[model samples]
Target: MSLVLHLDTPAWRAHLAATCADVPGLVPVAKGNGYGFGLDRLAAEADLLELDTLAVGTTPEVAEVRNGGWSGDIVVLTPWSRHDPLAVDYLADEQVITTVSRLDDLKLVAERAPRARVIVELLTSMRRHGMGPGDLPGVRSLLSSPQDSGLRFEGWTIHLPMKAANALAEARELSSAAASTIEAPVWLSHLTLDDYRTLTRELNVATRLRMGTALWLGAPNTRRTTARVLDMHPVKRGERVGYWQHRVSQDGWVVVVSGGTAHGVALTAPSPGANLRQRAVTLATGAMDAAGRALSPYTIDGRKRGFIEPPHMQSSLVFLPGAATVAIGDDVPVELRLTTARVDEIREVDAEA
Candidate 1:
């Protein structure tokens, strides 16, 4: 028994084809657990779709994508730096396009691997990585030198914040600034289809949109995640159980499901809480956590269950109240964040099945 993700092959492939048809110059991103579908699987899908380029998150991922059977131009989204020990290896490969965000890194690429293909990243409101517009002049001078650094200028890239209200305006302004210094294609992320069209029409340079989540998990109904029930034990009120020996509040069954911390269960990223309701929910969840009681993602009889204690490495102790009935070997539906989740198996089913 294990945590499994079931994918509808025909429906999922149809969605991919539809997304490709809608977005021109689409660069499929297969980074960070490949959005819950391992890199090798996504790499094979990219090949099947006949895409010419794939984008990864780091330098080491270059070989992963290559070995995964993706034999096309692979672009590393993370900017290159002297500190990156693995950067030098991929720099000499023509198919590997390294991202250069800082002036010094650009110089380093020019000095170390002059023949390397490079994408100069411009800083957006995200402020995470990339060179600012003020650094454009230095970048222009380096690339336009008489000595000719021998680097292939791939394009300019801008990664906008997901929740930015003026993402399109920011993209337009930054892209225009970068274009004035050097002419090349503009690669971007987090722009809507209409916004992409508007930017393409306004700018003279070509544009490519790098997409991961929207392209893969956009159709939520096409995929299903389930955890198998491994064991169950009845417990009376006030009885202590689990590693911490926490006392139970009511009579219930301690349902041991096949998922835990190792599988990304109970582990969560910090929530920013954009609204009052969200903040309230976060606060409530925090209170529950403080009380040593928290809700589990696993659901039974259309109701969310509660965890008896912190999840173990390979299984979780869920408190199923007396009203509900569950049996060992039964599969329980799980609401999971795919990007963080590591499932034991991924089963693909045809539409007819």
Candidate 2:
């Protein structure tokens, strides 16, 4: 069986509603592989929640939200460049908010999208895009022009690295600079609970948090994935099963079940260890896990099972000592991490006796 994305719609949505409930305003980031749920799907859900707007990673994904019957503002995180002509048309007709980083990029938006909404992306530690503090004056001059060019300067944007200490403090500095530069709102990422409260008081302007992960896929450890155990058999030491022809180390059950590299099982990443070799070890481990969506915590007889060997392309072999208690066509829960199995298909089967 191939991969099937098992979606717990109500559960996921409820979690999202609760996490973002505290914030006065929210701008859900619904771009870039839709963070595994696909773009249109995320937009539809965002629309249902009646968020202020939906943030996308790139311009192409705008169509995804529009196609989903969303009429809210489409905020593109990518900096506006003269390279893309369509930016003008979208800005003119739709509620598109283009993020401008460089002065030239801002000029491009002004020239092409004279009547467009723009957000000045300030430079942060990530250094992806955004005008630095030094460039603030130039940006203000463009906006302060007498003609105004119908350029609606709504706010500024900045993306911070998650899990970084003093992330909020760092953001406050940028936010302050942006606010001092213009009277527009602030759009940001990589902020913590304290940062929100502190900035909320320090910066007196409309602010929108362009958040994902925490808002949509928080506590990834809790989510579960599963597949059916297709078949099973007994094998002894020195016996070979898989096409690789590797000998077994012990007399354990040679269980043939569903799942493989295609499902993103064995695919894992290295841990944050002290040495380069330690980091390399994690990367190598992730490569195999990704290859064979090996069952890390697959449910068997209402209990999870363990893997015998690395997973194959389309199926995984598990050492099932409880195979007798369990049976064929049983549901196996695979506890999946969204960071690893962010976007994947899962196959579920009817549980058997």
Q: Pick the candidate with the highest TM-score.
A: 1
Model 1 clashing residue pairs (backbone): none
lDDT of 2 by residue, 90-117 (tens): 6775588888889887877787778888
* Off by more than 4 A, model 2: 2-11, 83-89, 146-149, 219-223, 269-313, 321-325, 339-353
lDDT of 1 by residue, 51-161 (tens): 899999998788787888999999999988788888778898878899998899899889988888999999988889999878998999988762688888988999999
- Give residue 239's lDDT in candidate 1 (0 to 100): 94
Name the 10 consecutive residues with the lowest summed lDDT in model 1.
142-151
Q: After superposition, how far is residue 127 of candidate 2 from its true place, in Å?
A: 2.1
TM-score of each: 0.97, 0.81
After TM-score superposition, what is the CA distance of residue 16 in candidate 2 from its true location, in Å? 2.8
Name the runs in model 1 displaced over 4 angstroms: 145-147
lDDT of 1 at 151: 86
What's the lDDT for candidate 1? 0.90
